[model samples]
Target: MTRPPLAVIAGTGFYDLEALEDRVEESIDTRWGPARVTRGSWHGLPVVFLTRHGPGHSVPPHLVNYRANIRALADLGCEDVLAVNVTGSIDPGLVPGDLLCLDDFLDLTRQRPLTFFDGSGPEGVVHVDVTTPYHPALRRELLEAAVAAGHPLRDGGVYAAFEGPRFETAAEIRLARLAGGDVAGMTGVPEVVLAREAGLRYAAVALVVNPCTGVGDSEEPITMEDIEAVLATSREAVLAVLDELVHTRATFTEEGTG
Candidate 1:
C-alpha cells in the first residue's frame, strides 16, 4: 500500500479523522519514541491522522510526546501537516466558533522539550528560522478551504501556547494579549516547532471555543462545563474545516505533481 503524504494532527475532543476512508492503523517508531498513526484515504488521496492528545483524550498538553509525534509523521513520508487546535480567543474580534489560521506563536510553555536537535542529533545546536512559524502555502490553502466551506475563518493570528492542565487566569489572559497574542491555547507551540524541525510544511487551524478568561461578559469564571459546551456546539465547524482541508491537500498534491 502507498504511504500517506499528508498528516493531520487532531486535538481536544477530535481524536479521530472522520472524513478519512479505508482507514488502517500504523505504528511508527522514531529515535525519540513510537507513535501510533492512522493511515487512510480521503477523496482518493492518501492521508494520515494522529491524535495529539491520544485516543481517549487522556494526555495533557505538558505530557504530549511532541517530538515523537512529528518524527513519526515525517517518517511516514508526510511532507505537509495540518494541525487543529482548540483555542480561547484573546481578542474580542475572534469570537467563539471562529476558525483562525495561525501565522505566529508565542511559546509560554516552561518544561516541554522544544527541539529535535540535541547534541547527539543530526544537527548540533542548530537554529531553524521561525520568523514565519506557519507555512504560508498551507495557510493559503486553509483559508481558501474555509471560504469554500462557508465557515467563519480569520486569515491570520498569533497563538500563545501555555503549559496547562488548567485554563488560564484572567490576569494571564490579559498578559498574553499584551504580548501580542490573538488566541490562547496549550498545544500549538512545540508541535508546530517540531514539525518545522522535521522538515515538514505545517499550519494550524485554531477553533476558538470560548472567550479567554477576561475577554467577554461572563457572569462567572470559565469552567470545564462551559468550555465543553462551547466545544460541543463548535464541533461541526471543526469537522467541516477538516473535510475542506482533505480536499485542499488533494488539490495541492495534484498541482505539485502536475
Candidate 2:
C-alpha cells in the first residue's frame, strides 16, 4: 500500500519547519482560489506544510480561503491533515502554553465559505457527518507521541471558532464556556469542516496562547506580543510532538506493521 504525504496546517508564528529538508514552495490552484504550500520531507515521510495566514501573516482569520486550502491539499494526494492552532483558553484551568488535542468545536462565525458542496456539483447537496470531527486514530497517535516525548497534552478539548481578526469579548467567552468550549480560536471551523467534506483524516492540536476575556484572573487585554512570546517558547514543544508522531509512523511503515 502506498501512503500519502501528511498535510500540516498552522497559523500565527509557525511560518516554516526547519526540520523539513529539500523544501520546495508551490502555489496550488483550486476551484475556489490559489493556495500556497511548501513540499518537503520530514523524518523520512513526505510532508505538505501550509501556513494558513500566508507569508508574513498577511491574511486574517475571516479572510482565509478555507475551500482553496483544503482542496489544494486533497488535490495533492494528502490523506491526513494535522492542524496546529494558536488559541485562547476558555477553560479557566487551562493556562497559557498548554497543548490540547481538540475533539469538538462550536462554530460562531457569521460569514465565510463553509463548504465545497453547493448542490452544483454532480454529488448534489452533501451534508457530511461530523459526529467525530477530529479523526480518532490520528488524535490517538498525537496523544501517544506527546506522552512519549515527555510533553503533557490534554487529550480532549472543545474548540470554539469565532469569526474574527479581533479578540472575543468577555460575554462571548462566557457564552462559549456555557456551551462547553475549552478554547477559543478564529480559524478552526470551515478548515476542519472542509477536510471532512474532502474525505481526509483530520485532527488538530491547539496551543493556548492566552486566556480569553474573563476566563482567568488576568484582567489585562490580549496582545499580539503576549501571544507571540508564548508561541516562540512553545513552538519547539509542539514540533517535538509532531516529530515523534511522524517518526513512529515511519518506523511502523518500515516494519510493515502500521
Candidate 3:
C-alpha cells in the first residue's frame, strides 16, 4: 500500500508553503464540518498543507474549527503531521525569531471541541493518553533538520495554549510561567489532542514572535506590527528547517531506510 502524505498545519503569518510544488487546493468534509487544504509535494514527497486561519487570516484562534481540520487531514491519508505555531516567549531567555521543538503542552483553552470520540461512534467515550504529547521520532527529525538547515531549534519546550483573539495578560503569562510554560500561543491545544486521537504522528515547531506580557524588561504591550516584523524575518528559517526535513524524508524513502 502507498504511504500517506505528510501533513503540515501552520498558524498565523504562514499562509502558504513556497517550497510546495504541484499544489492543488482541496476541500474535505468531515463529521465535524469541512476543512480546506492544499495537496502538493515537497522534495518529491507528497504533502498536505493546512492553515489554521482561513484566507487573509480571517479566523481567530478561539474560533478555529479544530475538529474539522484534524478530521480533514486524517481523511486525506496523512500519517505524519508537522505543525508550526507562532508564540510569545514565556521563558525569559527566549527572544523573537527563536525556534523550539515542543515536547509538552498546557491546554488552557476553555471552550473548544476537545475530542473526536464523543461516544457517538463505534469507538465510544475514548480517552487517549497524552504522556508524550509530541511524537519523539518526529521531534528528533525536526531538531536534526533545523541544525542541518543552520537554523537550530531548541530541543524541547513546553507550550501553553491560551484561549485568545487577544494577547495574554501579564498575570496570565506569569501563571503559565509558574506552570513551566516556555512559550505561549493561542492555537495548539485541541488540535494536538485531536491529532493523537486520530493516530497521526504529530510534532510542532514553535517560533517565538515576541516576549509575553511580562517577560524581559519590556513592559510594552504586544502589537501585531511588531509580531509581523518578527514573522517577516523568521518565517524563512522555519521553512528552511521544513525543507531540510522533507529532503531527509525523501532520501530515506528512496533508500528504503525510513
Candidate 4:
C-alpha cells in the first residue's frame, strides 16, 4: 500500500533533511510559479521537503515564493506540513538555541504574495478562518515529540513575522516587544497563513538563533555569522526533535491507516 505524503518546510541553516536516505527531486508547477521539491523517506514514512529559502539559501525572506511553495506541496497531496523556522529571541527566557513550538503569529510583512486567493486564479477569493493559524493536532504532535525526544522546548510562543532580508532595528524590536511578540523572524508570515488557506495542517517549530536586536548578550551588531554559530550548535537538538516528530507522525498514520 502507498503512504501519504508528509511535507516538511525547512528554514534557514536547515536546507536539507539529512535523515532522508532515499530521495528524489520533483519539480512542481503552480499558478503562482514553480517549486523544486525533494521527496524521500523518513523512518519508513514518505516525506517531502522544500527549502523555504531555496537550496543554496539564495532566495531572500521577502522574495520567497510563499504561494507557489504551499501550492506545490498541496498539489502533490501533502495533507500536513511541518514548518521549521529560524527565529530571533524577543523574550528574555527564550535564549539562543531554544526551541519554540509557535502557537500564534503577528504578521508585520509589508508586501508579498500573502495569499492564493487572487481573483485572477481559478479559485476566486475564498476566505479561510485565520483565528487559529496553526493546526491543533499537528501542534500537539510536535510538542509531544519534543518532550519524548528529551529536547528542551517551550510549548507555546508568539512569533512575530517581519518582512525582511534585513534584520529588525532595535527600535522595531522594542515596538514588537510592546506589541507582545516573543520571537521574531522573517519567513513565518504568508507561509503559515497560506497553508491554512490551502487546507493543509501546518505547524512551525522555531529555533531561536539570536537575541532580537535589543536583547540578550549582544554588544555588537548582529550578523549572519552570529546566527550561523548559534544554529550550528542547536542543529543537533533540532534534528532530534525532527526525528521524533517523524516517528510520531508515522505512529499516527499507522493508527489511521489501520
A best-first ranking of the candidates according to their lDDT comes to 2, 3, 4, 1
Query: Could you give candidate 2's per-residue lDDT for residues 7-76 as a string of tens digits?
Result: 9999999888888988999999998999999999998889999999999999999999999999999999
Worst 10 residues of 4 by lDDT: 211-220
For candidate 3, give the lDDT of residue 9: 97
Better of 1 and 2 by lDDT: 2
lDDT of 1 at 98: 84
Question: Which regions of candidate 3 are displaced past 4 Å?
Answer: none
What C-alpha RMSD separates each model from the true structure?
A: 2.2, 1.3, 1.4, 1.6
Pairwise lDDT winner, candidates 1 and 4: 4
Report the number of the highest-lDDT candidate.
Answer: 2
Give stretches of model 1 more than 4 Å off.
1-4, 248-258
In candidate 3, the residue pairs with backbone N, CA or C atoms under 3 Å apart (3 or more residues apart, or in different chains) clash, namely none
Clash count, one per candidate: 0, 0, 0, 0
Candidate 1 clashing pairs?
A: none
TM-score for candidate 4, please give it: 0.95
Q: Ten residues in a row with the worst lDDT in model 1?
A: 1-10
Residue 173 of model 1, lDDT score: 86
